[model samples]
Target: MSPTTRVLNASTKALYRLCLLLPLLANHEASAEPLVIELHIPDAPPLTFVNDPRGHGIVGDVAVAAMTRAGYTVKIHVLPWARAQKHVSEEHDHLITPLSRIPTREDRFTWIASIMPMERAFFSLERRVSSFAQAKETYRKIGVGLGSAQEDILRSEGFSDEQIYPLAIGDNPAQMLLMGRIDAWFNGVPESRYIWPKVSKRKLLMSSVGSNADLYLACSKQCSPEMVEHLRDAVEALRADGTVKRVHDLYLPQ
Candidate 1:
């Protein structure tokens, strides 16, 4: 073969090899570029907590795992429940996890996935009440976290403004119940169970007031539908692979 022809053939072979590697290089770069997502979580323990040195709890772990599997990098911000909801609602591309799926909040944000079922109930000193109706008759003041789903549920149940006691941020209603400031405390079962032992040693009575509601990952309206579906599918994959249950078991009360 002529010298020029040999050189041209060698160059063509090298160019073909480079072309084969280009797609792989592009794919690696795309995979390395993780989609950064902002997550807002509440301090509700056993389900979610910020006190841990790692800044995560059960739901936090589950959320991080799911988002990671969905090809995104997660940035978790622990905030008060009200503030978390507000941030997710007002900010673009923000998400809040483990929020109750209620009618009042259905249209406020894009629902991503159902994380777990939450039981809404009223907690009082043992023997104080057997049922919600009895509790309403026995307790004049019902304590609830201010602007919480518990408060909204109570109102929907026909609780008057005079009968409802809204507790400030970081306030524990179980302590208020023990202190006799309120006759009954309203909150989710998981949160109430986690807080009861921390606040008081007294036995408490629990009466379910509302149906079990599924907690969800809610994103800002500005979030695209494709992103929401991606998260939903991620959660489903986690659940199917037992990742969700494994994470929940790690933080569950033993």
Candidate 2:
């Protein structure tokens, strides 16, 4: 080829390299800005907590597994429900795990496919709250995860405004009840048992309060729809292969 033509081609190739490398450098700069996810991990009966790798919490384990499948790295940050809720609403690209897609939040964000149906209940000092009817009279002076869907249900059920109390994410609310802070703390069936051993030495009053909600993987209002679709596809594959239930059973309160 002629020298002029060769020089022009070489310059074009160099320009292409500069363009590609610029994005790569920009991505490197963006590395410090992580995609933050928020969730409330309460300290209940059998459920537990640990850092990444050990993954002791049931929902945490399931979430890590799903994140692995989705090919996205996630940092598990635990905080009180109020704070988590605030950040999830205000931040960009933030996410909340195990949030029930209630009517109010239906239009809030694009949702990833559900991870599992959260089976919930009430656990007291000694008696089992097997049904909502049974709990109607007995669940006075109750402690529960604040801003939880359970709290929403109870509020709708005419549980006195003063009767429902919010517990810290990692604090033992049942123990608080046993200590007389409240009468009982609502529990998620398997998650409570999963976390029980960590908080209490003995099995307390465990009952299904007849409340259940389909939990979903929810992204913040600003998250891209494409990201949600990819996560949904990843979750579908996990369900197809039965990994989802296996993860749940392994960590479920039994």
lDDT of 1 by residue, 1-254 (tens): 99999999999999999999999999999878988999888767777776787447677777877788888889888676777787788778888877788888888888889988888777888545556677667778999887678787877878889889988533478778899988888888777887787787778888755557888888997887878888889999989999878777777745
Encode model 2's per-residue lDDT on 1-254: one tens digit a residue. 99999999999999999998998989998875544444434333234364435464545556566666765677766676666766776767676766777666677765777777767788777667667767778766788777777677777767878878877644556568668778777756665655556666865777764676777777777877766777788778888998777766665523
lDDT for model 1 comes to 0.79
In model 2, the number of clashes is 10
lDDT per prediction?
A: 0.79, 0.68
Query: Which candidate leads in TM-score?
Result: 1
